[model samples]
Target: MSRRASGPTEGAVELRGIVKRFPGVLANDDVDFSVARGEVHALLGENGAGKTTLMSILSGAYRPDAGTVSVGGAAMSFKSPKQAIEAGIGMVHQHFRLVQPLSVAENVLLGAPSSFRLAGNATEDRVAELAEAYGIRVNPSAKIWQLSVGEQQRVEILKALFREARVLILDEPTAVLTPQEATHLFSIMRKIASEGRAVIFISHKLDEVMAVADRVTVLRAGRRVATLAIGDSDKSELAKLMVGREVMFRVARGDHEPGAPHLTVDGLAATGDLGLPALRDVTLEVRAGEILGVAGVAGNGQRELTEVIAGLRPATSGTVAIGDRDLSASAPAERIAAGLGYVPEDRLGTGLIPSLGCIDNVMLKRTDEF
Candidate 1:
């Protein structure tokens, strides 16, 4: 087991007794976290475990309702995201924020301080240089829409590094990448930390946390549970800390024969929101009383397949049938009426209305039946 130290200073960024609240929940309660320069620190938690809220406070997206945030040993009170950036803190959110129509270099240079004048092609050349340094290769002149999800992620990391962020926060950076791409990203993170910069990444994947982070701070129910060195901790220990329970990492799969197809999709074709071809001639079937897993690296038509089947997206060419009822041309309502219960991946927006109460959200699906 190997451990690296940040040298001199004990921590580069620190939070003490941080507290934040929403209308109905204590999002963060007297939580404390710290990361050191020249270290890759991982923040781990389950969903709604205050990981995002804590990072938001650190990045100046949300001022802490209470407590203190210090950067490079100096206390900080950030008024906006810009303030955080100026303080050498940069966060790449789980969702990409780049403009689709903008060139890679343009997006990297967006909102840069205009006080410093650059020679023509200097910005592009610098972007290229940073890309090469980080092992991220992308065409600087190409529009964001032309890049793959992995490539887009590279651009996000490059943008942060270009801004000279001393403390870089990446939220679920591998959620959209293949195993190979994730490995590459881990290498880049090591390079960044070795350069005397602080790298804080939010992740739920236990394997990644163990592999990339030198130290980890686990959050549970909006409070800090434990901060331990990677060499001393194992997956079972970390999982227990995150959930406050002994978690079973594996499930027993009982054998059962599959019945007739409950869901059938044939020759599905679709275009992404950018009007680019996403799915092509995909065919699959899920039998009744059996589980079917669609496994792939992210952004490889999995979302399109689900949307087309749920009638949320139009299929350019294909047929979808649920237990003999063809839903290829059906609207979402029609599909719902035909015994399709859709729970979208985005829980706040498409899955349920945030403003509406639970009763009302339930009624939204059965209003016609009522």
Candidate 2:
């Protein structure tokens, strides 16, 4: 574990000798990270490389078995997320924590200490001003459920800024955004950094890191591999540092003819959670031995369409045919019996029980055998 030289004026946010251990895994091994004031630092790693765990410690979600956290050149110990927020550290998780029924302003002020004293319109006005200043396009009065995924992300940022966070951490910030929306978010991050606030961006996409980050730190197998300035490093070098070897960016594939349609949807229409039109006359067909990707921005009826096809959501009008059988009106189990397998987005909550073992979870779909 290599150590970086640290001083009282080292950076706006700094972690020295961070070490965290799970049941049998050393999640973080003496990792040292720092972000200067007005800097955008990117944290890059492969899956299970201990990036999230390291940030969780800095955000007060977990205590480091060994290390010191400092913000604004002062040593600090955070026992909870609130403590971290109060000490100028705030984190927006990949999975948003906004309440669906609440308006953007309300969600931003949900846990605020002065929320009870602030007038409703006053809160909205303040939120609007903040949004405008940061160029974050969002309606403060709009309900979370009514906003697109990008808009919801803005609300999360607004919440952190409203709390006066000087060190903002975004975990996989662009995971659900469209290309245009992601560009807009990058602009917002730059604006925040320009205002003398530290922005720690955690992502797996090297292209985004190169595009938006001033410096990046790579972690591999619970250890810090390297930290380099954007100008001094390239994607290929970063990839090598992350995985300990050169990576192939391209693959050659042989072309093959697609067979007859295996699954088909005709004029599918469904309503969203708010009873608003989500899928409007959507139609598509999937051929055998071929992959059909449903590409769109989030909250564009993708979930509703999938649910309707799996018989979890009733379609207002449509026909879903698996092979030659019409399974539009069939139950989920019936659809499963018809050779249709569905993997929901919420894997832990909907697809399987977290407390159950793998065998028990798999047996959930084969209960009839018992």
Please give the clash total of every predicted structure, in order. Answer: 0, 0
- For model 2, which pairs clash? none
Query: Which ranges of candidate 1 are over 4 A from the true structure?
Result: 1-9, 114-117
Candidate 2: where are CA atoms >4 Å away? 1-10, 21-26, 99-129, 139-146, 240-246, 273-275, 353-370
lDDT on C-alpha atoms for all candidate structures: 0.89, 0.88
Candidate 1 clash pair list:
none
Residue 45 local lDDT, model 2: 95
User: Counting only residues 3 or more apart in sequence or on different chains, how many pairs clash (N, Cα, C under 3 Å) in candidate 2?
Assistant: 0
Candidate 1 per-residue lDDT, tens place, 250-269, comes to 99988888899988999999
Best by lDDT: 1
Tens digit per residue, CA lDDT, model 2, 249-335:
886666988898889999999999989999999999999888898988777889999999989999999899999898888999998
